[model samples]
Target: MSAPSTPPAADAARRPARGRPPRLDQARTVEAALVLLDESGLDALTMRRLADAVGVQAGALYRHFATKGDLLTAMAERMLADCSTPPPDPDWSGRLTALARRLRTALLAHRDGARVYAGTHSTGAGTLGFAETLIGVLGEAGFGPQEAARTALTVVHYTVGHTLEEQAALQPGDQGPADPERLREAVADAGLPHLTAALPVLTGTDFTAQFEFGLGLLLRGLRGLRRDGSGPGA
Candidate 1:
């Protein structure tokens, strides 16, 4: 007979420990990417940098995302996740204004956030849900599907464009005029008659006030469209 076999427990103990690392998924990768993104802008968010931040090898990132573009899209999806919440306002214009404010807040939360948001297609639940809400509001306001979609997109695009300029100006080394007198003098020296006349209000930039003012203008224009029979079902 062969020598007595080792006991089952002893045999199990003799096997080598599994050395593989824990697997990471898309959400975890996006979480790590966002942290890195908030500290450093989009350009610094390379796969190697993200992998290191997440405690994985660079190649492992490809398992969750095929390319950097795919990763950026995921980032954008997370950005809009908070926008999926239901609006508190009953009026269509109020709902649109609230939505615009929420989107602006989201874009301003991260470094270079607008750049990350720009040109990205997010098929994520949050993005779709927010779109559905906006369209629904427009529907309640007597807009057809096409006009409703256009209205929603117009608001979103305006928010994005405004926030892009806001974020860019906030970046390092791009501060606007600190001396009001100098700015006024420069404007006067330029001999821009109309611009000079408007310098008092134009030179002092209050982004919040300016955004709301412009939003009101757009909403007024939309209301005019509906009143004039230029809107859907007109």
Candidate 2:
């Protein structure tokens, strides 16, 4: 007998069969966390909940992420992964606009995504790469280093700010525009002729149009600065 022939069942138990289901990993962990976030906002995404979602013990999450903040930073970076991709458009302004649009779309894709992103200053691969792209475009477009950095920050801040407000407005509560008649009455009572005349446009907000319009204004200013050689210290 060959040492009483080790039981096949025992051998199989000692070594998981080839192609055994994959263990939980960082990518899968992030995916699970993101799904929870999309389905039920940020507040509901505790580590325990994430572990359960991924079919692991809560302590297992610590192997991938040291803290909740670490996870949130990872989540923000994941959302920004596409921004690192090179733009097809050659025009600097067009590239910047495209990046901004992509960021907005990513934020809007998840519930409270903007809030999650805005809450962190993550220096992850995706975040740094996106910054590099934005600043690199500005540098090639005749912006000094300082001006280029400022312009990049301006674009990012504007996108984050707008999306933050947009997401906030989506939450359930007294998101009151009130009655149309009441709004008209208030505007009429204000007695500012210019504002009164423009009340309809002001009261009816189109966020997409507003974002593009604001971005256009920023780009136009950068263009003017470049043409006049008045960028930064110049």
Q: What do the candidate models score in CA lDDT, each in turn?
A: 0.82, 0.80
lDDT by residue for model 2 (5-99), tens = 56554233323235653486897678777888877789988999887766667897898899998999899989998777867898988988998
Can you write out model 1's per-residue Cα lDDT over 130-222, one digit (the tens) per residue?
899888888888999999999889988998888887777677776542346787788889887897887766656577777888889989999
Which candidate has the highest TM-score of all?
A: 1
Residue 37 alpha-carbon offset, candidate 1, angstroms: 1.2
Query: How many clashes in each candidate?
Result: 0, 0
Question: What lDDT does candidate 2 reach at residue 153?
Answer: 87
Query: Candidate 2 regions off by >4 Å?
Result: 1-22, 172-185, 189-194
Q: What is the TM-score of each candidate against the true structure?
A: 0.85, 0.81
lDDT of 2 at 93: 86
Clashing pairs in 2: none
